[model samples]
Target: MLTFTNMRRVARRAVLFCLGGMILTACSGKHEGAARYRTNCGICHHGGEGMKGEIPPLIGRIDLIAATAEGRHYLADVLLNGLNGPLDIRGVHYNFSMPSFRNRLSDHEIASILTYLAARGDSARPPVFTAEEIAALRAHPLPPSAVADERRRLDGIHRLP
Candidate 1:
């Protein structure tokens, strides 16, 4: 019953099955945002947790940020224009300049990244960024300092965490 041909057949089937699964996942495009996030944002964000003292976390906070219309616009603006100067996140001061991806990433890619971050939060309804929304933000560019100012304004109204 345990013949060499039978063993070979089983091994081949296993290999084919593994390959099929990999191919299906690749084609699904479900991980497109994840792949982009890993390559672009993971360095600073570090699994969306951010650095303890340096960078601000995105996981538990982004959804809250994207909840409002102004907040959604702010998120898009941040991606397009970046943010510079001091920030008081959850009462901790962080002074770091986030580089703009305006020239580097496409609108779709930026939307994917934002959508990915928004979805990672525990919000009942996470905001989904679209290429059109990103394009709208792209049309009217703001300075990094201005984006920081917007963040401050938003913090005043929302009590950002």
Candidate 2:
């Protein structure tokens, strides 16, 4: 014989508990994904430390590169096919070849990395690259027609000191 007041209290408590559980679950998932990035991608990325003149920083340059359509397309292509030579970011030159993860990583893994980068890293606009998108990129690989020339062209853009 529970009163209406007690029922309301129980229901409220149940709702609160459910909400807290959901929040904790979401946080844990994010943490796990970030840890994966550190284990896998961190080898080359290195959080932009000790990579100043080699690899491009993934943190603050997201806004500069992800803001426009061309930049986004370039990023997508790079992820799929990998880019070689020098990349100029905000007047700084990064000379390194970004290797493709197509064969090494699964589509889901790539999607998760992109999602994490877009959500947590610095990007002008958040990206939503799905597993399906990765599949499509794989299906139609970027042509290797002028990769060398493109690299040279990018090098030209770098300010010579």
lDDT of 1 by residue, 1-161 (tens): 88999999999999999999999864444377788889988999989988866998889888888989999899999989999999878777789799999998999899888888888899988888889989988999999999999988998897876
lDDT of candidates 1 onward, in order: 0.87, 0.63
Q: For model 2, state the Cα shift of residue 9 in Å.
A: 3.1
User: Per-residue lDDT of 1-161 in model 2, one digit per residue for the tens?
Assistant: 89999999999999999999999976765665466567767888875342667666776554344555445445556666777765566566777676777677777677666666656655545665567766876786764334435435443654212
Best by lDDT: 1
Question: Backbone clash tally for model 2?
Answer: 1
